[model samples]
Target: MTTDPAARSAPRSSARRRNLLLVSVLALVPWSVQTFTAGSATLLFPWGLVGPATGSVTTITDFFLRFTMGLPDYILVWPVGVACYLVALGSALSGVLFGREDVRLTAAGLLLAGVTQLEVARGFSVQPGRTAWPVGTVLLWAVAGFLYWSRAGERDAR
Candidate 1:
C-alpha cells in the first residue's frame, strides 16, 4: 500500500481554498447590506438620506430641507447614487464571477439594513435633524461587520 505526496497535499489545498471562499462569503454579508442600504437611499429615496428611507414624500422632503439645507443646489443625490449603484453592480458581478457570490449578497444586505435604519430613525423623530442619523449609520455598519466576522468563523468550521 502506498500514498502519494501529491494526493495528500491536494486535499489540503482544496480545503484551504474552500475555507477562503467560505470566509469571503461570510464577510460579504454586512458589507453588502450596508452598501445596498446606502445605495438605495441615494438612488431610490427622493431625498437621498441613506439608510431605510422609509417615509412619506413629505417626511422625506422635510428631512432634506431641515438637515441638508443649503449644502448644494442639487435637489437629489441621483448622480452620486448612480455611481454607487454602478459600484455595487460591479462588486456583485465580480463576486459572482470569482466564485464569491456571498460578497454581492452581503453588500446588498448592508446597504438595505443601513438605509432601513436611517428611514426608521427619521420616521420616529418628530423633527429629524442631522444629529441622530450619523449615529444610526455607524451603528448599522458596526453590527454588519460584527455579524460578518462571527458568521465567517462559524461557516469555515463547517
Candidate 2:
C-alpha cells in the first residue's frame, strides 16, 4: 500500500483556505454592524439591540445620537474603520494565497481585540452597545490563534 503526498495534502490545503475565508468574514462583522448603524436608527435595533417595533423615531434617533456621541471622533473616523477592514481582508487573502501562516495575522487579530477592549472600557459608560465590538474582535482573535496553534502542531507532528 502506498500514498501520494500531494493527494494527502490537497484536502488540508482546501480546508485551510475555507477556514481563512470564514475567519475573514467573522472579523468583518463588527465593522459592518458599526458602519451600517452609523446615522441610522433602523439599523440600530439589530446591531445594538435597541429600539422596538413600535419605537418612535425620536426614541431611535436619541439612542443613535447617544451611541455616536459616546465614541471619540477620532475613533469613529471613516478612514480608521476602512483601514481595519482592509487589514482583516488582507489577512484572509494572505491566508488563501500563502499556505504557510504568518505570525502577523495573529498579532493583528490580538491588536484589534485589545483596541476593542480599550474602546469598550472607555466608551461603555456612554454607549453600552460598544460592548458588542469586543465579542466580534475576540472571536477573530480566537480564530487566528487557532490557526496559528494548529500550524505549529502540524510542524511538530511532521
Candidate 3:
C-alpha cells in the first residue's frame, strides 16, 4: 500500500516537534537543578523567584554551606541560583521556539545557554558546586549544539 502524502509529512513534522521537546527538556534540566538548590537557602520564598522553595532536597546553596567552602558567604548576598534558573528557563523556551521558522530565536537560545553556563560557573567558583555546573553545562552545550546543527542541516537540505 502506498503511503499518503499527509502520512509521510506527519512523521517528519512530529519528529521535529519531538526533537524540539527533547531539547527543551535538556535546557530545563539545569534550571530545575538550580531552582531546587536556591530554594533551600531559606524557608521563606522570594516573591519574584520562580520554582518551589519548600522541601528542597539538594541545592548548591546547601552543599556550599555544609562544606564550609566560603562560597556560600558570597552567595548570601545574591540570588545566584535564581539568576541561573531564569537564564535556563529562557534557553529552554528559545529551544522550543527555535523549531518554528525563526532563526533569531535559536540564536537567542544559544546565547542564553552560554550565558547561563557562565553564571553557573561563576556560582561554582564562588561556592562549592563548581563540579556540578561543568557537567551540566557540558551536557547543555552539547545538546544545544546538536539541535542547532540539525536545524542547520535541515535548512541546507532545503
Candidate 4:
C-alpha cells in the first residue's frame, strides 16, 4: 500500500459512483411481483411499468397494478401513490449521491405507497409462494444499509 491518499481515494470515488449508479438503475427493477390465481402475474417496477408474470399467487395483479402501475386501463387510479413513490425514489437517489440518511425516507415512502395501494384495493387476496420476493426492494435496502454504515464508519475513523 502506498502512502498516497490520492491513490487510495481514487478507488473509493469510483466505488461510490458505481454504487450511486446502481441505486439509480435499481429504480428500473421490479420492486414487487403481483401474481393471480389464474396463473397470470405482473411486475411492479419503480419506474411505473407492469409486465406479465409467471409464478404462484402473491398479489392480485389487477389490484396491485391498478395502484402501482397505473396502466392505460387504470387511468383513473389513484395518483397519490405514484407521487409518493417518486418522492421516495428521489430521496433514495439523493441520499446515495449526496450521502444523506436514506433508509428512513425510503422505508416511510414505501410504507405509504403500500397503504395507498391497499386503500384502492377493495378486496383482494393471494398466497405468496416461495418465489414471491421483492428482489429490487431487498437489494436496494441492503446496499443502502451497507453504504450508510460504511460511509459513517469511514468518516468516524477519519
Candidate 5:
C-alpha cells in the first residue's frame, strides 16, 4: 500500500496546530490561587504574567503573605519554576514552527518540571488561615501529559 505524501503530512500539521493552540491557551489561564483572611489572589494568569503581577506562583503568593517556610523564603521564591515555564513555552512554540521532535519533547518535560516545582513550593507553605488552590498546576500537568504521551506515541510509531 502507498500513502499519499500530502495526506500524511496534513494530519501531522493539524496535530501540530492543535498543540500550539492548546499550549497558547493553557499558558494564559490562571495557574494558581489562594485566599487569605485579608483577600483572595489569583496568579500567573494572562494579565498577571504580562501585567502588573508578573512572577512565579511562589513569588505571587509571597506577595500576599510570607509562606512561613522552615528555610529562608528566598528558597521558595527562586525563579527555577519560572525559568522552566518560559523555556517550555518557547520550546513548544519553536517545535511546532520548525517541526523539531526534540524541542517538543523537551517542552513537555519542562512543563512538568515547572508545574511540579510550583506545586511543591505551594504545599510546603500552607498554613491554617489560607486556602490554597493549585488549579493552574493541576491543569498544566494535564496538558503536559497530553503533549508527552501524544508526541511520544508518534515518535515511537516511526
Candidate 6:
C-alpha cells in the first residue's frame, strides 16, 4: 500500500480543528453560567450596586461601578467571562480558517485569564468562600499557557 503526504496530514489537521472547537465550546460554559447568574446578589454574583437589577444592566453597572470605585472585592466576572468567550471564539475560528493557532489570540486569552484570576483572588480576600469558583478559570489559563510554551519550545527545537 502506498500513502500520499497530503492524505497523511489531512487526518491530523482535522483532529486539530476538532480539538480547537472542543476547547472553545468548553470555555464558553463558564461564560454562560456567569451571564445567567449575574443577577444574583447574595450568592456567586454578589457584586451589585443597587441590589442586582434585572437583565444585563446589573452586569454592566456592576463592572463600571467596581472599576471606578476602586472596589477590589467585586471582581467583574461578567466582563472576564466575555473576554474568555471572545478569545475562545477567536481561537476556534482562527484554527478553522487559518489551519494554525493564532498567537495573538492565545496571548489575549492568557492576559484576560491572568487578570481575572488576580481579580478573583482579590475578591477572595474579602469574601473568602464565595470567590473560589474562578480558580477553575485560572487553572484553565495556566494549562493553556503551558501548552503554548511547550509547543513553542518544540517548534524552536526544529
**Highest TM-score, which number?**
5
Question: Could you give candidate 4's per-residue lDDT for residues 22-79 as a string of tens digits?
Answer: 5556556665555565676566554444645534333334445544453432222335
Candidate number of the best lDDT: 5
User: In model 1, where do residues sit more than 4 Å from their true spots?
Assistant: 1-104, 107-133
Please, what is the TM-score per model? 0.29, 0.53, 0.47, 0.51, 0.65, 0.52
Candidate 1, residues 61-131, lDDT tens digits: the string is 45556767554332243234334434444444455456343543444554544555455444333333322
Look at candidate 2 and give me any clashing residue pairs. Answer: none
Question: Model 3, residue 5: what's the lDDT?
Answer: 82
Alpha carbon deviation, residue 59, candidate 1 (Å) = 5.4
RMSD of 1: 11.1
Better of 5 and 6 by lDDT: 5
lDDT of each: 0.42, 0.49, 0.46, 0.53, 0.58, 0.52
After best superposition, candidate 5 residue 71: deviation in angstroms?
Answer: 12
Find the 10 residues in a row with the least total lDDT in model 4. 122-131
**Which candidate model has the greater TM-score, 3 or 4?**
4
Q: What is the C-alpha RMSD of each candidate to the true structure, in Å?
A: 11.1, 7.5, 8.7, 7.4, 5.7, 6.7
Ranking by TM-score: 5, 2, 6, 4, 3, 1
lDDT of residue 119 for candidate 6: 61
Residue-level lDDT of model 3, residues 1-158, one tens digit each, is: 44698776665566456555655565344431242343343221211223344544444455545754555443442344344434544554544555343433443454455545555445645544322234445555565567567768876975
Off by over 4 Å in 3: 1-8, 31-104, 128-132
Ranking by lDDT: 5, 4, 6, 2, 3, 1
Question: How many angstroms is residue 133 displaced in model 4 relative to the true structure, after the best TM-score fit?
Answer: 4.7
lDDT of 4 at 127: 40
Task: Report the error of model 4 at residue 31, Å.
Answer: 0.5
Task: Tell me model 5's lDDT, rounded to 2 decimals.
Answer: 0.58
Q: Write the per-residue lDDT of candidate 6 for residues 5-104, one digit (tens) a residue.
A: 7886686477557646645544433321221233343223323322334444344455575556754444555456456746755775677677776655
